[model samples]
Target: MILQLIQVSKSFGDHQVLDDIDFELKEPQIIGLVAPNGYGKTTLFNIISNLEKPDHGEIMIFSEKNTNEKIFEHLAYLQDNRVLYDNLTAREHLAFVAACHNVEQQEIIEICDRLGMSHYLDKRVKKYSLGMKQHLLLAIALISQPQLLLLDEPLNGLDPSSVKLFREIMTELFNKGVSIIISSHNLYEIEKLTSNILFLHDQKLIRNTEIDVPVDYFYFLSDIRKIETELTKNGFFWQSKNSVEFLFTLNECQKEKLEEICQSNDVLIYDCIQKISKTEAAYFSLFT
Candidate 1:
């Protein structure tokens, strides 16, 4: 494994952000961290980067304990534009990172070209747009060629073209055996990147698998009140009921059972829709 966390916990006085979270990742893999704002996604990244000491437990990178100095050598974390010096041009920023990592200048230029950042790399960061800044941040992370890459909201303000470019670069890096962990609010983009997802909820880590498969069946019943008890008794939770009808999320097995229940209860089926991706439904299922 490239990264592992064992019983990690962190708290800030009244708020217990992370609670005994255990996670592991292998090399050359891309994992998505999905959560809402203030859900300790950033806190987890900080702990991995050794910016904040965990209240309890341990973090291991490449089987070595993650430390402050060692992380700078083997890890590259792209947090936000605040890390950028507004007065420095993109080239200057890249050069500074390259110097710290002992990367050659020509290699930095090549990375810029590959990421399509050569157009505005010479302009000061203050004058660059959000997309341009995102490009710079990604380029800086790539310059070090880090064995473990941690990206927090990397695609936040990128345009369509830049988003496509970022995905391409991420794929290239993954192909080269760079283990990456990305935290993003973009569910669709996350689905496109990887199926392995770690969801943080109620100060705990929930590993959600099979996120790549689209839900095969979604059923809406015309008379939900007639079979509400039977549905819940069978361990199937129906969605909202504000509409005249009710929607129930189900899988292939549940669909078969639902058909039998509907037949017995005489519940009229209004619609059956096939979904393209289950990421959204899976996300909301955590809350509901």
Candidate 2:
């Protein structure tokens, strides 16, 4: 296995963050880590990177026990951009990393070129925009040529073009046999990257696989009681409702028929939203 976590557990005082977390990633693939804020996502990444020791657990990487120094040889953790130094140039930042990791300077240049950062490689980080800093952080991570990469909110503060660029870079790395675990709040972006999702909830890791299924449409209305029979007869189920509107889930094929029935029954349709993916639906189901 490329990485394995056995019986991982961590607690701070009385609050337990993770409990008996066991996960394995054997292939070169992308994994989407999903969880709410303050749920120890960063803490888990720290433990894997050896920045924090687990209260009780063992971490194995590349078929060997991971040591503090040795793991950095093959594992790259692209943490928050706050770690970047404003006084240093992008070229200098990558040069330092290359020197520490014994990576050739030429290789760093190649990575910068690949990531389209050659133009700003010599520019001071203090003058760089958030998107530029993000690109530099990714470039620094690539300098190590890591086999296992952990990225935390790498897409944050990036523009639409930058986001697309980042996605392309991730795809390229995966194609080159790099196993990556990305934690992001962007569900739509995650959906495009991988179907393998790991959700952290109740101090446990839950694995969910996204599969092909019929898309569900949620209709919002003032009151469904008047047309509840029409909805149930057509396989619609009450999803949620509030003072403003009630929401119900129906098959995409039933949208036209539903509208027809609602029009005839005087059921006002405030809005109708086509659900994107089951993963998104599952995420909303947990929080909403």
Candidate 3:
């Protein structure tokens, strides 16, 4: 195990945040931490980083080589609220981080180049965009070479291409035996990045199970794509509606064939989210 939390607890005033939290980190795996905001996910990261003392319980790890000597040495956390010197140029910032850790200047430059941060290295940190800042932070984290890397919503504010690139980098890192722990609510991101889910509900882990994408009716998606052509060719009696999500009424045989096609395409029907119905749920979570 890389890291373990045994029955951890924390509170402020009368409000309890983390309640008897127990979890472990295994190497060569990417763990997804999913939960509502203000549910103590970040708080737990703080505790693990030794930023705050736990009220009770223990964070235990097996004694390994150089493990106890630097309990935090193997842990690197990129908090949601990013930290950077506003006055420093991006290159200066990277250099400063490298100096702090005694990383070679050549290695720092190589890391910046590899991450596509070279062009903006000379730009002032305050002028850097969110994506650039995130890249810089990730570079710093990688330089430290922590066995366990914890990121809080790393994909926030990134463009689609950047998100895709970041996912690729994460996959590459995991392949190299780096354990990643990320907290995100974006199911699409989770579905793409992880095989198991650490489903957090009400500040306690309700489940940690394999992420199963429910099977979708196979031919349904194909039929929808070629609806006009298929309609004229098959001469089937059916109805269609497009108020919001795609809707169709097909007879038994058509429905069966559609299911078969969709299943073959790895489309999961039950995972489809109906946004109109979920609008209320979204509003309450955001405003209430």
lDDT of each: 0.83, 0.83, 0.66
* Residue 54 lDDT in candidate 2: 92
lDDT of 2 at 69: 75
For lDDT, candidate 2 versus 3, the one ahead is: 2
TM-score of each: 0.80, 0.78, 0.70
Which runs in model 3 stand beyond 4 Å of their true positions? Answer: 61-69, 208-288
**lDDT of candidate 2 over 160-277, digit per residue (tens):** 8888888888898899999999997777888788988887777887765532334566677756777778778877766665654545454445666778887988878888777566
Candidate 2 stretches greater than 4 Å from native: 210-274
- Residue 204, candidate 2: C-alpha displacement in angstroms: 1.5
lDDT of 3: 0.66
lDDT of 3 by residue, 66-134 (tens): 224466566677875357888888778767767867789888888888788888888888887888888
Worst 10 residues of 1 by lDDT: 209-218
Higher TM-score: candidate 1 or 3? 1
What does candidate 1's lDDT look like per residue over 1-288, in tens digits?
788999999999989999998887865788889988778999999899898899999999887898737766778999889999999999999888999889999999899998788888889899988888888898888888898999999998899888888888888888988888999867789888898788888888776764332254556677777877988899987666555444566665777798889889988877777665566767877754
Model 2 RMSD in angstroms = 6.5
